[model samples]
Target: MEIKESTLDRVKRLKEKYALIGQDIDSYLDGLIYANPLTYWDYIEVDSLLSLQKPKTDFPDEKIFIVYHQITELYFSLISHELEQICKNGKNISDAGQDLGWKDNLDVNFFIERLKRVNKYFEALTRSFDIMRFGMEKEQFTKFRMSLLSASGFQTASYRYIEIASTDLKNLVHESKREELWNADYHEQLDNIYWRRGAVVADTGEKTLTLRDFENKYLADFHRFADEYQPINIWKKYQELSAEDQKNPLLIQRLRELDINVNVNWPLVHYRTAVHYMGGAAGDEKGTGGTNWKKYLPPRFQRRIFYPELWSETEIEEWGKSWVEEVLAESLKTEEKLKDEL
Candidate 1:
C-alpha cells in the first residue's frame, strides 16, 4: 500500500511539471510508445557526415583529398568555438559602453587555458597535413585538381573569421597597405585585407572569382564580427589583464605559439603540399583556384603575422623568408630526384 502511494505521488508531480509546459503526461507517454532509443550513430549523425564527402571526380584518391579538407574544416570549427567563448568572457567583463570597473580584473588564467586549447587544435591540424602530403598519388591528384577550378581553400570563411577574432583589424592589413589606409575606417581597411590583396589577379590587379565569391557570401558578416570583436579580441583582452599578468611568460608563450602555428607553420606545410604536387619539374601547373599560388601560398610572401607586438623588429622584418626559401628548395630537390630516378 505504501509503495503504491509513493508511485502515485511521483506521477502526480510529473503531471504537474508537464502542465507548466502545456504538455499532457498521458499524451507524452503515448508518443513515447512509438519512440526508439537513441544510438551512437544516430546521435552523432554518422550517416549524414559520411554522405558529405561526395567527390567531384570518380578517382579513388580524390576522396582522400576531399575528406582531409573536410577534417581540417571541422578542426577550424572547433577552434572557432573556443575563440567565441573567449570573446564572450571578455565582453562580459567589459560590455559596450561600461568602464572596466572591478569586473575587468577577471581571472587571466581562464583566458590562458582557452588560448592553450586553440594551440592544441592547431597542433593537431599541422600534424594532420602528413595525410595530405603522403596519402594521394601525384598523378591522380593532378588530374582531379582540374575539376575544382576557382574553388581554392582561400575561400574558407572560418579561417578569415579566426584571424579577425585573434587581433585588431589594423594588424591584418599588409604593413605597406596599412600606411595608406592609416586614417581609413574599418570597412575600408578590411577591403585591403592581406588575404584579399593576395587573392587579386596578378596582371589585372582585380579580385579573383575566389575572393569575389567569398566577399559576396561573408563580407557583411565579417564586417559585423570585426566591429563586435574589435574591443574584445584575444589581443585586446590580454591588454585588459593586470600589469603583472600581462607579462606572464606562459601567457606570452601561448600567444607566440598561436602566431607561429596559425601563420608560419600551417601555411608552410600547406605550401609544401602545393609544391610537391603542382610545382618542380612538373612545371608551373596552375592552382585549382586560378591564383598565382606560388606567390600566394607561401608564408614568406604572405607574412601574415598575427601578434606583431610580441616579436622583435628584426624578427618581424625577416618573418617567413628564410624558412620558406629552405622548404621550397628542399621540395624542388625532392622533385628533381624523383625525375632522375624515373
Candidate 2:
C-alpha cells in the first residue's frame, strides 16, 4: 500500500523526526570533519560574547578588564545555578536518610549528578580567573585603580551569599536546636536524620571540612562517576585515577586542585585588582565597593582562619584567658595596695 503524503502528514512526520534526523546528520558531519579537521574551523559566538565588553575608561587595557570581569560573572552565574541544584539534591538525600533510606534509585543518581555539576562549575570558575589574571598588568592596572571606587570583590552578591551559606551550614549542623538547623532545608534534613536520629557522629569535632578535604571529596565522587562515562587512572594509586577500578583517584585529586585553585585565586584576584589597578592598595582610604576594609573582623573568623585546627580551642581559651589574666593582675594590685597601707 502506498502512503499518501498530505500537508498534515508531512508536518506530523517533520515534527516527530526532525530532532532525531538533525542529531544524526550533525553527528555524521562532525565525525567526517574530525576525520578531516581542516574542513571546518571551530566556530564560536564571538560577536555576542565579545560585544559584552563595556569599558568605563579609555585605558587600552580597559577592554580586557571588562571582558575578564564579564567572563567571571558568567561563571558565577553558572556556579550559583549549580549550587542551588546541589542544595536541592543535598536536601533530598538528607531527607531520604531521615526516611530510613527510602530514596528511589533516581533520587540517589540525581544527587550525585548535582555534585558532579557543582565540581565542574568550580573548575570553570577557576579557569576563568586564571585567564583574567593574564590580562592585568602591574602598571596599567594602577592607573585605573581609582576608577574602581567603592567596589570590591567581596561585594559580589552571589559570592557573599554562598560564603554565608557555607558558614551557616556549619553553624546549624553544630547547634543542638533542631529548629535552627532546619532553617536551611538541606542541612535541616541532614540534621533531622544524622543529628536527631543519631545516625552519624554529631561532632566529628571535625566541624567543617578544610578546603583540602572539600577538594578530595569532590574529586573522588567526580572520578567515580566519570569512570562510567570517561575513565582515567594511574596505576597503583596515583593522584590521577585510572579506569581499572571503579574508584576514581584522579577525579578526587582534581577536586582538591580545583578547590584550592578557586579559594586561592579569588583572593589573588582581589589583591591584584587592588594593587595593580586600584592604586597599590594604599589609595583605598575609604574602603572599596562598600566593604568595611577597616572594620575589625569578628574574633571567631580570625581564629578559624589563622589557626583553623584550633579554632574551637582558641575561641574557648581567648574567652576565659582575658578574664583570668585581669583577675590575677587585680589581685597583684590589691596586694600592692595592702602593702602600701600597712
| Residue runs of model 1 more than 4 Å from their true location after superposition | 1-36, 90-106, 321-342
Q: Tens digit of lDDT per residue, candidate 2, span 63-101?
A: 777766676677667765654543333333443223344
The alpha-carbon deviation from the true structure for residue 308 of candidate 2, after best TM-score superposition, in angstroms, is 9.9
What are the candidates' C-alpha RMSDs? 9.9, 20.3
Residue pair clashes in candidate 1: none
Which candidate gets the maximum TM-score versus the true structure? Answer: 1
TM-score, prediction 1: 0.80
Model number with the top lDDT: 1
Off by more than 4 A, model 2 = 1-48, 90-110, 127-130, 164-265, 268-342
| Cα displacement (Å) at residue 201, model 2 | 42
Per-residue lDDT, model 2, residue 169, is 30
Q: How many residue pairs clash in each candidate?
A: 0, 16
